[model samples]
Target: MSNSLFQPITLGHLTLKNRIVMPPMTRSRASQPGDVANELMATYYAQRAGAGLIVSEGTQISPLGKGYAWTPGIYTPAQIAGWRQVTDAVHREGGVMFVQLWHVGRVTNPDNTGGAQPISASAVKAENVKVFVDNGTDAPGFVDVVAPREMTKADIQQVIAEYRQSALNAIEAGFDGIELHAANGYLINQFIDSESNHRTDEYGGSLENRLRFLDEVVGALVNAIGAERVGVRLAPFTTLNGTVDADPQTTYTAAAALLNRHKIVYLHIAEVDWDDAPDTPMTFKQAIRAQFDGVLIYAGRYFTQQDQAAKAELAIASGLADMIGFGRPFVANPDLPVRLAQGFPVATHDPDTLFGGGEKGLTDYPVYQAAK
Candidate 1:
C-alpha cells in the first residue's frame, strides 16, 4: 500500500514534500517591547521545517489588533524585517511557509491594546474568556476580556485596510502565502458567529449582514494578494472563546461557498480537539467539500504512529482532507514526517513550558533516535 501521508502534493504553485502540515501554535516568545519575530523564532520554525507546510503563529495585523503579550505583529517595518529572517530560515531548509494574519476583536483586554477599547462587529463582551497581557511583572498574566465597542463604518474600513497591508507585508517578508486567522473566536469569528454580535445595522442581525465584515476583509486580502495566495481558517463546531453560532452547519457551509467564489487557495477547518470534544460530523465535512474546491486541511488531535496515525492516513485515503495537521505532536517531534513514515514513537511536550518560554520546550526537543 502506498503511504498516502508521505506523498508529495501541490499547494497553490508550490509542491509540498509530504501531506503533513505544521499548523500555527502560539508560543508567545516574540521579542519584548516590540513583539517582533527574532532569531529564536526563526530557529524554532527552521527546526520543524520537515513538514510539507508551516503556518506561523497568530501575527496581529496592527498594534490595536493585538490580544496577547509577546505575540508578534506584522504591520511595522521592523516587524516585517523580523519575519523576513524567520521566512528566510524556513526557506533555507526547503520548507513552504504561510503567515497567519490575526485580529483579536473583542477577545482582548485593554492592557494588550494600549488601553484602547477593542472593536468588534458589535459591542458585546465575551463571557468567561480571558486574554494574556503584561501585568507589569516579568511574567505575563491573564485578565478578563472587556466588552468591546461596536465598530463603525470607518472602523470596519480601516481594519480591512490593515488586513490588506498586512497581507502585502507577509508577501514582502517572503511567505509563500497568507492565512487569515478567522477561527478560535477571534475578530473574524466575532463577526461570523451570531452569539457575539448584537448589532442591528447592516453589519449585523441577518446572516448575510453578520458575514459582511468577513466578506469585505477577504475581498480586501484577495485584492491585495492574489486569491491563489490567500487562505482562511474556520472553526465550524467550536464554542472556544465563547463564540457559538446559532446554526454552525448553515453558517460554515455558506462560509465555504463564499471562499469558493474568491478562488482562495485553501480552507482550513480547525476541528475541536480537546478531550471529550465532539468530532466534526463527516456529513459537515462532505458539505464543506461540496462548496469549496480548493485544498482542505484539518488539524487537531491527529496523533503520530498509532491508531490516530492510521486515522490520519484513512482521512487522506478517503479524500476527506488533502493534508493532515498534527499540532502538539509536531511540537515535540521536529522530524515528524520521517517519524510518521517510519512508525517511530512520538514524544510528549512539556505542558508547563508550552507557552511563553525560551528554547527549553520550544526548540530543545530532539529527533526520534532509532535502536541500532
Candidate 2:
C-alpha cells in the first residue's frame, strides 16, 4: 500500500512537497558569547532539506528568554544575520523552514539569565528539573532551577512585545514562517498549564484567563507576520519541565479551539515520547482535530524509533493528523524522506554528541546506500 506521507499539502501560501516534517529539536551549537547562528548551523539545516518542512530549533526572543547556553537567538542584529545564513542555506536546497520562537519562563536559573531571576506565571520552581548552562568548561553544566519571580503585568506586556518583534525579525531573517514555542513547559507553557500557573490576574485562574497569554501572543504574531505564516506547538499530555494541567483534555481542547479562532497556519502537538509513557487518548486527538481546522502535526514516539515510517503513515491515513514530524530520526537520517519512502534502514544517532557539539553527529549522518 502506498503511504500518504509523501503527499503534497497546501499550508498558507506555500505548497509543501510532502507531509514529512522535521520538528525542532534543540542542539546547543550556536556561537558562544553572542548566541548567534552561523555557517555550521546553516550547514546542519541545509543537509536536512529533504524534509518537506523544517522547523528550526527553539530560538530565544530575548536575552531573558534564554534557558540553555549556546542556543540561538533572534533578538539581535547579529543573531538575525546569523539566522539569515541558515535560511539562505535551507532555501538553496529547496527546503521550507519556520523558526521556533521560545522563552523558557521559569525553566532557567540566574546562571542562564545573566543574574536575573527567572520569571513565570507565578513564583514557582520546576521541581526535579535541571536546565543546561555554560560552566566555562568543555562539558555543559546542569544546575537546579530556582523559583521564578511572579511576572508583573508590565513584565507580561513586555514579553508579548518581544514575541511580536521576534516574528517580524524572523521574516527579516528570510524564514517562511514562525512557530510559537507554547509547549514543553516553556514560557508560554508555564502560563497555559494549570499546575505551574497560580495567578489571580486576567492571565490565570479561570480556563479563559489561562488561555489569555496564548491568545495575545498568537494575535501579536499574526498581526506581525499574518495568520497564514504562524504556527503553534502544544504538549497536552507531558508533564515535561514541570508543567501539569489539572485537566489536559479540557485544557488542550480549549487551546485547540482558541488556535482555531486565530486561524493560525497549523497546530503542532508534542506527545510524550519516553519509553513507558502513557498513550495520548484517541478521544483527545479526535477532540483536538475537531477543534482546529487547519493543518495538524503530531510528533513523538509514534510507535518506535525504527517503525516511525509505518506508524507515521498510519497516523496520516487515520485522518487525525495532516502531517508527521520525525525529530530524532531526522537527526540521524538527513535524507529521512527518501529513506522512509523507499523503506531504507534508518541510522541511530549518537546520544553523546546530541546537544552541544560540532559536526560529528550534527551533519555527518549520510544518506542511505543500498547494497549493490
The best candidate by lDDT is 2
lDDT of each: 0.90, 0.93
Alpha-carbon TM-score of each model against the true structure: 0.98, 0.98
Supply every candidate's count of residue pairs whose N, Cα or C atoms clash at under 3 angstroms.
0, 0
lDDT of 1 by residue, 159-244 (tens): 99999999999999999999999999999999899998888888889889888888999999999989989999999899988899
Q: Write the per-residue lDDT of candidate 2 for residues 80-161, one digit (tens) a residue.
A: 9999999999999999999999999999878988999999999989999998989887468999999999999999999999
RMSD of each candidate relative to the true structure: 1.2, 1.0
Error of 1 at 240 (Å): 0.8
Report the alpha-carbon TM-score of model 2 versus the true structure: 0.98
| Candidate 1 residue pairs that clash | none
Model 1: residues with Cα > 4 Å off, grouped in runs: 136-138
Work out candidate 2's RMSD over C-alphas.
Answer: 1.0
As for model 1, its CA RMSD to the true structure in angstroms is 1.2
Candidate 1 lDDT trough over 10 residues, lowest sum: 301-310
